[model samples]
Target: MSTDVAIIGLGIHPFGRTPDRTGLQQCAIAVSDALKEANVAWNAVDFAFGGSTDAGNADTLVSELGLTGIPFMNVANGCATGGSALAAACNTIRSGAGKLGLVCGFDKHARGAFKVNPKEWGLGNWYGEEGFALTTQFFAMKIQRYMHDYGITEVALARVAEKAFRNGALNPNAWRKTPISIDEILTSQMVNDPLRKYMFCSPSEGAVALLVCPASDAEKYTKTPIFVASCLMRTRRFGTLEVFSPSKAIEDQKTVTQDASKVAYEEAGIGPGDIDVAQIQDTESGAEIMHMAENGLCEDGEQEHMLARGETDLNGRLPINTDGGCIANGEPIGASGLRQVHELCLQLRGTAGNRQVKASPKTGYAQVYGAPGVSGVTILNS
Candidate 1:
């Protein structure tokens, strides 16, 4: 017997700038909608897991949403929190510890400057620098390096931004739906060297929730259910330092992303060619290009070629980020991973509407990464 977990229902509370609702309120809205969509009551959830960062305590948020008397846990893996929560829920159900599980993710934009806990990095008040200082700057450096090494042009990056914005225009819930021209993208104020504002992900507030249950209970809830074929997550070992760093001489080293993708493909009994659709975490345009190569969608240094050929567009051979991705949809921090899964579920169910691909998508993949080198990949099949 195949021990496959099923997603009976999914809910997303938009993806954009919202100043009125708190993170807790967004969580409640998503969770309630998920339960109603699955035709299951709150008490039916055998386990609950909330994914967030510094938004608030998961336990308290669950309590505020009236999720009590249940085994609940909080997951904080930076940007990958939502995907981590789903993986945990899948493991619990696969272990037969729970028949039904609920995973909720939400976040509110930081009121002022975004800061990190000093203890996490073993730094004290000396690390009072603004949050974007390190994170965005680090990624900007990577983008510059990638461009130089691969000879990728700015036009290639503009293509990525344009594609995402076009997709976002079709998604009512997306944060920035207005389509931008390549000239506009190139002229946008540069956030970092070689990375314009259009390449950066916008901060937004939203929530997302998912209901996972045993395959047996799938029919009881929704007739058109998606199966969790596999969930894979891996962290970068000291070995990856060589693969990603130009100074290292380790020629055989593999990136943390490729390592995680290998495990996920093996567990799903499929290869990259079998993926019908994908929702990759592209906080920046460069990320999407690099991930395409790292995830085996194309050969190393060939991402720009693929993009120029229109292979990564909505009507392309293997459509990616059909729901606009973090680039165009806005990154709601905690809810991003689940939002990716939600888009995949919608596509697999053939309910994506105007943004749907031409081919019949039977399998979908979602990937998200966070700082501290955390990563998550989930495979869903219809």
Candidate 2:
């Protein structure tokens, strides 16, 4: 693990609809909670970085969070916003330019917020009009191809959703609190072929904040400080199949998440086998199944047996998405990736409440994939 930076505090705003409060209001609350957890006043934060997809500007948070005059930059990377923010803060501290910093993300999306505009990417207006631009359709096609090629079955997709909701029921901050059966998920409305309505995450609202400080001062913040092993972000390669890509190159290459994960493992001085728990990008059920392999947690086609044997459960060999992930927690865009890190922190500290892994996990991994082919991976150890 890295000896340069440590996560000293964490704060979260419950995911889902909150008609009464604005998105900025929620962000202020998360920051306040993080400062309290770190036992520091707002002015002590030497730098700040955060943002959202649809919520107001992040720099405006200074008004409510105190006019500390610290350099607060706004991150607007698609679904990788939170992860990108964390990387920036960590690098800032590692550079010895700051003693302490804050990374926060929050978003408030409408019921159907992830709509795509093909023309914006130069894919042509027909792309959207012909339904080739819907994200759900792309996920369905990718998983369907994998099933045909690797023997993954439709039932495996349902199993992923089943596990997500089961874990979500145990998470107090999760949006969907009730468990959903596999059969219910199997028969749910078919949003896209092979992908059901229950298998996808909704566009919702949430906020997450994390406090980073020099590892040397970790003991003063909390007894259970979680050190940052490595945090890396990468963009799509020419031949990779990324979101919103009209076509792939003639030669196939590893996905952005796959590349980022492998490099992160090397940087952290550990391999996939050392990871005891993970929170992967589950924008849809199939994304989790694919991400499991993409992140090197499992081999291709092994997911079929793993899910069938209940090896991915909270008490299983490797607990994935202990907080229900995007599938159950809903995608808050800016906050989603940070939500993964927040969950990893709690899991590593043994404070995840009812959703805690049965075995005390020493190392945790988190990955997030976003639009236009950006991926971020983080490794943490207790």
Candidate 3:
């Protein structure tokens, strides 16, 4: 369903390593850009919410931000951090507790996949020792099973990566800007069985921020405001089957992405058919394929067909991951979701140069899912 909140400004720090700057520093840069775009001063913000993984607490930003004294919440919900923060910020406005709010995400991670501990995730320590906890391992197994069940090919995986990098080439801020041929991608070293090194996104660093205000007051901030149609976050419930998951859902059941996407669509009063563009989680090529179906953009096994038909191309009927997604942008966990939103806002504003969707997209969708079964979805309309 429609909401009164509209995003008045957007800003981002390029998604990649900046050894000279700390994660929080990057966040500060994004915040300044966003505030400047919205023409809103820091002290004028009624409230703020932000999140990060490796960065310092988001609330600690006040020391450098002039201590506006507004409530600045710190969120840590793994990769879904941005989604949660944005939802909270929207609710703050919808609840009449605040008229203007800011939400941001940023992080800096070491090379390679995250070192996740089962116990740290609330599971037994044995789950980690037995090798049932690594993100790459679980992703590989899940995708392998999905490929078999749906007749997806190894070529499809390479195509996904190829598309991601191709789009990244157009995105100046993307980390992997050079496009690679499918042959080169397919020949890349295999990281986990069918998942090639090129197919997976590295754990990297970046930051993103957005300014939101009541739709009635959007003109006071910016000339082009993307209305917040809906924003919701959900977590996997009982009987959800994620193979490596320590929970009892291994037998298989509804996923958090499915549930969240459905509710988000209902709230936004739109469906997949209305989305001119989309940006779903693509930690790897396989995740993109699975999320396409899980988010109801397509039916089971239809991603292969969708890709084959060029439906996801920049000039096609629906362009997805126009900013290159996680594969080309790298996953800075906290900032990834907001990065998707930022790209969508650009498209809706008709400012996505070089990589812009030729169709003049009016509506967009995004989904971000991560560890502990948390998932978040948002719909935007211009």
Per-residue lDDT over 135-197 for candidate 3, one digit per residue giving the tens place of the 0 to 100 score: 887789879989999999889898899999999999998999999999999999999989999
Clashing pairs in 1: none
Error at 281, model 3, angstroms? 0.2
Please, what is the TM-score per model? 0.93, 0.98, 0.98
Ranking by TM-score: 2, 3, 1
User: Which stretches of candidate 2 lie above 4 Å from their native place?
Assistant: none
- Overall local distance difference test of candidate 1: 0.81
- Cα-based lDDT at residue 234, candidate 2: 97
Cα displacement (angstroms), candidate 3, residue 296, comes to 1.0
Higher-scoring candidate on lDDT, 1 or 2 = 2
Name the runs in model 3 displaced over 4 angstroms. Answer: 247-251
Candidate 3 worst ten-residue window by lDDT: 241-250
Q: Mind giving the per-residue lDDT tens digits that candidate 1 earns over 1-382?
A: 1437999988888877677887777888888899999998888888988877646766675566564588889988778888889999999998999999998898877632245554574455444443432456556776788889888888888889989999999888788899998899999998877888998886678889999999888999998899998886777765553212223345446767788888888888889999999999797888888878778777868888788898888899989999899888777778999999999999999999889988989999999877756678998999
Taken over the whole model, the C-alpha lDDT of each candidate is: 0.81, 0.91, 0.90
